[model samples]
Target: MGRLHSLRPAMTSTDLIVPDPVFRRVPAAFGLRWWMAGWRSFMQAPLPWLGLAVALLVLLWLLAELPMGGLLSQWLSLPLLAFGVIFAALLRKRAEQARAMTPQGMPVEPQNEGTLSSTTQRWTGRIGPLLLVSLLVLALGGVIGAVIVMGLGAMFGLGLASFGAFAKVMTPGVGMAAGLGALAGSLMTLLLLVLLALYLFSVAFWFVNTLVALGGVSPWNAVKLSVRAGFTNLAPITLFTVLLLPISIVAMLPFGLGLLVLFPVLSGASFASYHDVFGDEAAA
Candidate 1:
């Protein structure tokens, strides 16, 4: 009874996090590894992974019904993300068991469960910090949106002015050229803004959970470090999000069926990414 009970968290942040964590820059192509690891982890225990994904989806759905459910759900996602990391760790341990052999050619038993039991407690203990991080990230999103909107509006305004208003802009020659130029410029500006936000999300916000959960970082520090890490490894971050854009659309196409896999795979990816960026001494 005692041993079985110990399979979950005691809910302590200080005890679970690594002290003074270090981060390494990964190649642009390393994004492939993060997704690959996530995919592999999902395949390792498909049923349980899907079950967890279903639960998370339901939980978020329920949360969305509340007065400020969207905000609440954002805060809640961090701890849940940590749980995803724990599941990923479990999958890793299982893989280790299957491949590890003793000198006698017998499968060797793992000495202990690695980071599986304590991860839940770790993040729960840091819920306050996680909420703060959520707020911070959301606030940044708002600022980014506002700036992009202004830039776009200005762009369209200039186009209209140059073409001598709506009717003139639609005219056959000079107006048409001006209108097209303005349209192209507006589009280019919008694309740049979108990429900027994506860079931050991929480089900065995505890792906030692992930074706080596994690295034991404070909210402010985690944000700072995440942004810095993202900037240093912009290539991989850019590539990962570009590919993820389509996968995300596909995940949504099937009446959200893909979420059952997508959510869990994301958690695994988060786990894999954190370790890859910080797990190795080379990152140091």
Candidate 2:
């Protein structure tokens, strides 16, 4: 009787305490709902889109200059980059303004308006200096990262070549078997590259999440939390990414014109994803 009673309670406890399903990372996604919300929000205040457009155009123009070089190219690219900064500052101001005018019709906080306006002024006041500073910093970081990745790739290639030679000697009887093995090894290497890409993307997303979560604490703290939550909820992130893949391919079909809509939606959804995970703490 005692054994049966103990087993009944154990069964009841097991029934009561359900284990969380590993695959259910994302809250029930309503892609249409998220897309509609993102569209409405972006359309209501398109300054952020405008800013991104300006940045993209400037980047394209600069890249074009490389092929169509000369004094004119240099003159044009330099000025466009400068103007892109002004547009960014303006866009930031408009974004702040839009945030203040929330749909709730709740009384907009006076302090919020004041702080936003102050930030706007500061951004506009020293746009040139800040842009130059940012450009130099980004260039340096890009160069260093590129060098490191290139070095790693060279080392990997050298190792693969050595392996190919060893495989040829060890399996001489199996004609072309060594070559097939090398090809398979190359495929495995490619898979590793893809994994690395995902890791880098995860890191980048965490960084952006931290940047967007400005205030309340240091960016480092935000980064730590973002990375932790992202890994914890990888299932949803993976699902969303898979869903986006087809959309991205379609967007690229029309010479990237669809990107204007697709890009903003993705950006807003990223913000939404963060909001879903961290709630108001991230919203701030």
**Quick one: best lDDT, which candidate?**
1
Which candidate has the top score in TM-score?
Answer: 1
Instruction: Write down the lDDT that model 1 would get.
Output: 0.69
Instruction: Compute the lDDT for candidate 2.
Output: 0.47
Counting clashing residue pairs in each candidate, in order, gives 2, 0
After aligning candidate 2 to the native by TM-score, how far in Å is the CA of 231 from where it should be? 1.1
Model 2 worst lDDT run, 10 consecutive residues: 1-10
**Model 1: colliding residue pairs:** 24-283, 28-236
| lDDT of residue 100 for candidate 2 | 55
Q: Tens digits of per-residue lDDT for model 1 on 188-254?
A: 8778877776666656676777776656577788888888876777777677778888999999999
Cα shift from native, residue 90, model 2 (Å): 14
Q: Estimate each model's TM-score.
A: 0.76, 0.52
Give residue 247's lDDT in candidate 2 (0 to 100): 84
Q: What is candidate 2's CA lDDT for residue 212?
A: 25
Candidate 1 lDDT at 223 equals 85
